[model samples]
Target chain A: MNSVAQTFSTAALQRNPAWAQLLGLCPLLAVSSTLINAIGLALASTFVVIGSNVCISALRRIIPDAARLPCFVLIIATFTTMTTLVLEAFAYTLYIKIALFVQIIVTNCMILGRAEVFASKQNITATFFDALGTACGFTLALVSLGVVREILAYGTLLAGAHTLFGPTANNWTIQLMDQGLLPLAAYAPGAFLVAGLLFACVRTLRSFKKIPPPKSQSLIQD
Target chain B: MADLALLLIGALLVNNFVLAQFLGLCPFMGITKGYDTALATGIATTFVLSFSALCAHLLYHGILAPLGLEYLRIILFIVVIAGVVQLVKYYLQATSPVLHQLLGIYLPLITSNCAVLGVALLAINANLNTLETLIFSLGASGGFTGVMVLFGAIREVIDHDDVPAAFRGTPLALVTAGLMSLAFMGFQGLAG
Candidate 1:
């Protein structure tokens, strides 16, 4: 497997920053109550991660060893501020709802982790793919968690689509059920529960592939 | 006084930094393996949270606000928090080598703990006065420590119990935290 495929796999499943490494749980669980909010925050984070990766990888040669962490943080925080300001301008309402978590992305270890572990060591092209893959993984976790929480809590999908989309998209909210859904699914505790289930499911699935039982057992017996 | 009391209660119970708002969860989950470790992490976090709250309040009002650098608050607040963590680490190293050894890597890791920065930003956002911010930080950290110790104890107990196949480690910890959060939900209507 080439570096691109390796990085992509790492981001998507094998070492997904959200699930496998559990780097950015705060933002992962905080703003994922609704699909729109999830998309909004995910996009912002993707932008910051990609931007920071590019910057850090490009400047890797120049950044001193002692000052590496601070430099990486400065670059990440700059992109975070840029994303925050842009979102505040265009997606004002969504920005307000997620303002706290959005700004907190500066502290999201995923981006910094990518910077230190992958980007700073790799070339520009390789780093780009790594960043993209990692961002997609993060987005995957966010949207899935958001979908589950939104469906369970509000009995709807795209309930706040208008926040991200324009006025024309205001009617995009899809009602799934009338009532009887657990409201706890939309809150922080629910995020933990859903996240735990998701992690277990993934782990179980991975475990199945790890053992080709008949072939391995026969070989061992022989 | 009543408002301050309400603020304390709100931070502690209603809007808990971890179970409810999801702030500082990295440490809440990562360092909570044992009771003593969790207590150390929680107290270290509380110190950073409270100290950063005071510093952020002062900086936001005195320097950043005066310079109209509100947009720079995130970057500046993070820098401040990181600086405070370093200072605290150094202070511990100088005065309490045993404590420093106990904390180990967690001391520096506090800079990345969202609770410290979250508390600072939350206090600034709430526009709390200095005293109010201190009280709020106290409550928030107290709540954080309380939950950490609680979760630690539960996890230690669960380690001895017979658990299912897939949900042995982190998944179990999270599910336990979920149930604890549900129990904490009972405190919802107590505030306000």
Candidate 2:
């Protein structure tokens, strides 16, 4: 388990491209209510999935296979328009509340499903540790669903960390509850009821562990 | 007519495209479990999201806003919504060979559905004109095929109500699409 701590524990815990391959759940439930807009669109989709998985694994040999999925979607739409012009020049009000989910992160099928399953065909340092373990498992499911929907809708937790840290991180707001919060965990049906109770609390903590399940998974953690 | 009935009741119930702009939730919770393949994957994602919003409003105002190439309009609206989902899967495999065999491979994954590139980048960022971008892409694909056939007929009656063992399947289909997005937030202000 060495490949750089198996690329940060296979991106913040075994293959969690947003809780185990539910790939970018629409910008992980739209700008995750806030925890500085889910760590500024999870650090601009972990810098466009590790700069389009090391430039599609150093242009995986003259990219032919019938123009490889439109050249890995034009190198993940030119790093999602260079991460939406560097989040509209340094987090301009959390880039206007996540500029259309940062230009729909060029249709985030988890950055073209890690540029068609592990950067075209791995190399450039195992396609930069499978794009830094699938962008640290999609920034640990957008910072743990933006810290449980900003601590159940604005009870507060890094309430607006100086809109992505600037102006001396303006008193980094963490005022956890002065009242019984739960304003539907801040709308859109409380980000689908806190992403279905955070995938039923990671399928009841991976059913108390005794491992083994794997194989073509998806009961989404069940 | 009252601004196309307030842009077709603001895209069939105030800004809906899958419960208030979460835009095409990976084919609204993966081809909404059953109900005739969720009404044939919501009528093949309402004909590739209103024909990629009338060809991304005539190729972003008659060719990428007069060749400024508006930052190559998200790589030319994902190569013309993957060539209009391969011309609606060879025009539904030559005129409905049983809905091209019940939309296999969810009709070319509706060209990577971010709700068909969020209704062609919200009809070219709502500058909209050509008949209000084809009535806001036929009212956002008739409100995404009326909430994917009302969340596929309430996920076929919650797949015979049982649901335990760590809230079976995608946590009971994302808590029944968060109670049908809180009954579509009571159609908020019913289009003002």
DockQ of each: 0.50, 0.25
Candidate 1 Cα errors over 4 Å, as ranges: A211-222
How large is the C-alpha RMSD of every model relative to the true structure? 5.6, 21.9
The collision pairs in model 1 are none
**Candidate 2 on B1-192: residue-level lDDT in tens?**
898888888887787878877888877777677677777887787888788778877888887889887877888888888888888888888987987888756877777888788777877886877787778777887888778888878887887788787777677888788888788888888775
Worst-scoring 10-residue span by lDDT in model 2 chain B = B102-111
User: Considering summed lDDT, which 10 consecutive residues are worst modelled in model 1 chain B?
Assistant: B102-111
- Please give, for residues B16-61, the per-residue lDDT of candidate 1 as tens digits: 8899889988888777888998998888888888998899899999
RMSD of 1: 5.6
For candidate 1, give the lDDT of residue A170: 86
| Residues A31-95, model 2: lDDT tens digits | 88877888888888888888887898898898997768878888888899888887889878888
Docking class of 1: medium
Best by TM-score: 1
Tell me the tens digit of each residue's lDDT in model 1 across A9-119: 766676677877777999988898888999999999999999999999999999997788888988998999999999999999999999999989998888887887788
